[model samples]
Target: MKQGLEPAARFAADLAAVWPEDERSGSLGLAVSGGPDSLALLLLAHAAMPGRIAVASIDHGLRPEAAGEVALVERVSGERGIPFTPITVKVAPGNVQARAREARYAALAQWARAQGLGAVATAHHADDQAETLLMRLNRGSGLAGLAGVRSRSTIEDSETILLRPLLGWRRVELAEVVAAAGITPAYDPSNANADFDRVRIRQALAEADWLDPVQLAASAANLAEGWQALSWYAELDWHEMVMRDPDAHGGLGFTYCANVPRVIAIETLLRIIGELGGHATRGEAARAWERLWAGENASLGGVLAVPSVERVEKVGVAMRVWRFRPEPPRSAGH
Candidate 1:
């Protein structure tokens, strides 16, 4: 009993580090899918905050076995006297994994709201973070993508808080917790499917002797810290060097005649594009910023960026200003 309680104690400490005690006194919704990691999360959460925690199992309805998985989680929650909610969500067509993730979060957010839960916690362990970093690195992802999954963030289109307190925990460690509890975790066949990028990456990581998932996960955390600093700097730059161009015909403009760090400029442009109701990936935003910095025109995500020659009264010369606006609609084919 002491040995089993050790992991739960560690989990409580880790969770407390991220979620303050005052705030954690409220209800926390656990997203348990009956997997080893999430089942471990359920056990740990129940032990850590017995009365304050509830369990939720999302059934994406992709596989018939999902019902069994949800039932397993519900049963475990019942045994612990934790409130359990089984949410069934429909994943839209296209990109099975991605769409399922979207559906999962959407359902969780709605459920959290309905339950009046202060936060929703998911079991995203260190190995998962390492896999995410490698996958993004393979695609030459920027700082944000390479930062991997954040420990805490807000759900999209919702005010509910999402937490991943197990980011520092290893997959094997979570599996051990479940094993010790004498629980048989539900098997998800998709975990072994090679068609999925994460499955392939996980297999490669298993075979690669030189790679350490713990170290990789640490690197990703470090990157996340660096990205946070850059984001703060970008906000500062936005306030100082950015303004709405009166002549831009309802758009934004960035004004800087002096030298600015390439990285900071890209982040600033990302902010501007986002504010203007346009979307651009980090790579796309970087390329667009580079073109605009070269005194050229560029377009990204329905937003057009054009350099304008304007007279600066203080400088007494024609300085180039970058103007961003929605791209004009094209006429019939010429």
Candidate 2:
């Protein structure tokens, strides 16, 4: 029941704030998959930024109709005079959905870099955010994972904006916008594949009557807000005890947490180790870290061995991080 162009206007405002390319002229590229969500984004960006945005349809060529749908996307892009770039991809079962998505983004990101574009926008919306939040929570991810998708980000040294203006709107609202604008988008069949966790989550959402979608969507936003605040605090205290933060060696580096308060130091050290551990999600890492600080330098991350000699140590291998306290070597005469 929202009035005409409300979402479009809001979307434009959000993109403008996120990109702000006037300060730095950019030929932004968008990943338009010929779906309602992406199509609406293309339409709004075309209307808002005029020549500043370009549309690219990644024809995964998974379905028989994919190429033709890509043609429709090309036609739409032609209507706006935004150069359409179609990159065809092979979506194989062996590659998996994640592989396909990763490939799509990699190709698009490379294209953006070549064109000297500063931002690339995708059509990830509120429902996507909700599903992602649930997935990360189900995995018992940390507070950072609860933040859901970011509004904007820099990946691979490219200062590209990831604008998700539609992230607050529902699928129904987006569908209405696309229909009212008279755009029929091709649906990706892969979205229904139950093998993928995201697709399964979507199916689950569609069937769940007890769970309120609107409330869950709001909860995602609230979780994102809370996660950001907590991350700031975690980083603030962690920096104090980070005497020698982890280097490119991909393992925990020595830290001087002695000056920090007992409770604060313990938490701060755990955060440091967690950060250094990268994707390692072992509770044992925390225990190993605590043991190191508690006067028993033990090997952590399976390789760097730390034997307490008072000062903490971090090495290329966890089994070698030893506390360096000089022990006098007996002379040959003695």
Candidate 3:
């Protein structure tokens, strides 16, 4: 078992390193799920931050025991004299896990905003980061996807930050912290369900003596640094080489010089499509990139990319332009 106060001190130090100075006066919202990981976070955060923390538990309503699990967290928060709020969110159909996650974060963001909190903290530890990296790797993800969970991030478009203070701590260490605190956390049965890919990955990692969560999490952090560098260069290229097409009908098109590097061109096109509310998968984007590279017109994600002639210094030159035109809505019973 680990020393209880040591974990609390470590969590505080991590938070102090990243906590924005402008938000020093604001309280933080903690998302606790009554599991060992989140419960350990709640206890540690309370010790470190004291009365400045607001606790919240999101009930996805997918399982019969979810309400009871949330109640357990509420009871613990009450014992610690921390204000607790229980939030219930409805999970929509299609992709249950993804939908549930979106709903949970949406609820948490809304609650944090209402409470006037500056940020919401979650209990994603090093083991979770390792699992995320493996999952993305299995899907042949790019560098950005392989970066796994970030220590701090914005939830969608919200200004309220999402902080993962325990990313440096291992799962067993958290369990030990909970045990040292004399707390019995409610177990979530889904964690052991082999049908979930994450559970299978976690089991495999547990059985593999050669794999270490600390090393995997470190690799993910390194990839995150590389991803940041790529994004920085992409943004610089976008500003220098891209502009609004003056001839486009009502400013619907984006024009870019053809002399930019191939990678920057692809990144600029993707960003333009995203800004225009177009949804394109990685495969679709890759195909579009190839078409553009071949000097052929391409259409994807409700956007069309075509070669254009522009007069520069009284000389007509070839340029690439993307126009945003969404497809018409389908009528019922065609």
Clashes of each: 0, 16, 0
Indicate which candidate wins on lDDT.
Answer: 1
Candidate 2, residues 1-334, lDDT tens digits: the string is 2435466577776676666647546777888888898888888777667888888888766678888888999999998789888888776577566668767777787788778876788888878887887788788875556678776665544455556666766777778778988888888777888988888888888788686655666677777777666556556666643555455654346544344333344345455445445222335545655676665754443334343334334422232123211223457988
Residue 299 miss distance in model 2 (angstroms) = 4.7
Quantify all predictions' global Cα lDDT against the true fold.
Answer: 0.86, 0.67, 0.83
* Global lDDT of model 1: 0.86
lDDT of 2: 0.67
Instruction: Tell me how far candidate 2 lies from the true structure as C-alpha RMSD in angstroms.
Output: 7.6
Question: Model 3, 5: alpha-carbon shift in Å?
Answer: 8.1
Answer with 1 or 3, whichever has the higher lDDT: 1
Each model's TM-score, in the order given? 0.91, 0.73, 0.90
Write the residue-wise lDDT of candidate 3 on 113-229 in tens digits. Answer: 899998899999999999999999999988878999988888985777989988888999889878988989999998999999999999999999799888899899999988888
Look at candidate 1 and give me any clashing residue pairs. none
Q: What is the lDDT of residue 165 in candidate 2?
A: 65
Rank list by TM-score: 1, 3, 2
